[model samples]
Target: MTPTITTFTQQRVTVADGVALNVAVGGAGSPVVLLHGFPQTHLMWRHVATDLAADHTVICPDLRGYGDSDKPAATDGRTYAKRTMAADVVALARALGHDRFALAGHDRGALVAVRAGLDHPGAVTHLAALDVLPTLDMWEVMHGTSAAVGFHLYLMAQPPGLPERMIGASADAFFGHFLDGWATDPDAIPADVRAAYLKASREAVPSIVADYRASATVDVEDDQADRLAGHRLRMPVTVLQQDWGTALGFDAAARWRAWAPNLVHNTVSCGHFMAEEDPGEVVKALRGLLSR
Candidate 1:
């Protein structure tokens, strides 16, 4: 029972780097681009997008390495870096006639959204990140025994080949682990949508792992450079998470405030799949960002 967006029109948008992203467009107001997280497609936004569409022109894109979007072979993880993926989103919005747009992303997409806000501050009017920390802060807090929570991050950070091969060997189990483990209500994803996620992940093992690998390496360098330059997101930013920071022994909001001067950070009781598990709260947070 995958959710459907009957009001939206779909298109294949070729970005500046020639990667064609599958995007869904709907509604009629100020533009807002929504980026879906790992192992899920733009279809993940069916609930929240439909709600936002009443007052916004919502654009949801399947990120380059996931879903039906173009999955280019990784050349040392650079291709899947959030920097590159962020550019694709900016290009997608520009191609569709928006010089600037509001942006929101969850999970891996949150990483991309953060990069987009950092790299193209002038283009992203408002930013929202769901359930993720900036790459540098993420790695900083995830150390010693705490690192075990993000074991996949370490596994994928390895030098390609082996991680891809091992994940490919049991793709369903690997993908299902996240879908099941992260969601408060596993049924929130529904069977068909879960099946779609599994299928896409199984096919894009290498590219998917490259995306994570880039977060550990190149993405960190980029974030660190920006921090050194004293750069912060200029737009109003909202971050909603499940209080992993409390469990991980870091002030999540304080950490986010370092990069987002004007930020409204809150922790939710919902699982990592906040958008699906608690669309009302997610929508409320996005609307707050939009209003700002």
Candidate 2:
């Protein structure tokens, strides 16, 4: 059987235009909304969520295009844009009686969290992004041979149909490749959890591809506009990442500092799935962020 966060109640909450998200809510006190990354679901927070729930109200939701949430069709460029997804997160929190909350996300979800912090600064009191650079900086820094590490980004950024079909044809192999390769500790994701992630990704190829496609197009445009307007994250921000900048040839903290003046950037000693591979460290970083 697949595992879930302990002591959390699962529910389906409608966030936008009849689109509902499958979410897990637990604990009391202050509210914190946690978003999961690509090739995975809210289940990625199984350890971290339970730990935080000891004192805070934790909201863990499957992003619209992944897991059990409503997968709306990507009718236009805006459909799966981070702006639209960020609105879904704000709506999810408000529906759960939180006008303002702390927010954290990993991988693709980190992209969404950054958008939420930028677009709804008043709504997100504290922000944490684990293992991802902002969209605009990500596109700017990835160059030449180093770009090969992110081949999936380029693959899914193609013009819709072909990318979707190609990934769909051999979904498990494609998704499992990341699951196998990106982790320094393979045992961090147990066999059943790995299976669950593969199943979710396999079933949501088109929507998943649409999410990445938007990152390449609409998300970049949105970030660029924000940059040109000199907008920055107002809340305190925490960024935990592996030392990818050393290999990618760009100062990760410097790039993040451009958008987040109030930032605490740390290079974690783990893989991309740090929340799973090293949940204790992730929880520690998050707890420190919440206190700030």
lDDT of every model, 2 decimals:
0.91, 0.93
After superposing candidate 1 on the true structure, give the runs of residues whose Cα lies further than 4 Å from its correct spot.
1-4
User: Per-residue CA lDDT of candidate 1, range 1-292, in tens?
Assistant: 2233678988889995658998899998999999999778888898999999998999998899888789888966579889999999999999999999999999999999999999999999999999999999999998778778798999999997899999999999998999999999987998888988888889889989999999989999999999999999989999998988877899999999999999999999989988899999999999988998
Model 2 residue runs over 4 Å out of place are 1-3
RMSD of 1: 1.5
lDDT of 2 by residue, 189-290 (tens): 999899999998998999999999999999999999999999999899999999999998999999999999999999989999999999999999989999
Backbone clash numbers for all candidates listed: 0, 0
- In model 1, the worst 10-residue window by lDDT is 1-10
C-alpha RMSD by candidate, in order: 1.5, 1.0
Native-to-model Cα distance after best TM-score fit, residue 119 in candidate 1, in Å: 0.8
Error at 47, model 1, angstroms: 0.3
- Can you give the lDDT of residue 125 in candidate 1? 98
- What lDDT score goes with residue 100 in model 2? 97
Q: Which residue pairs in candidate 2 have backbone atoms (N, alpha carbon, C) closer than 3 angstroms, thus clashing?
A: none
Which window of ten consecutive residues has the lowest lDDT sum in model 2?
Answer: 1-10
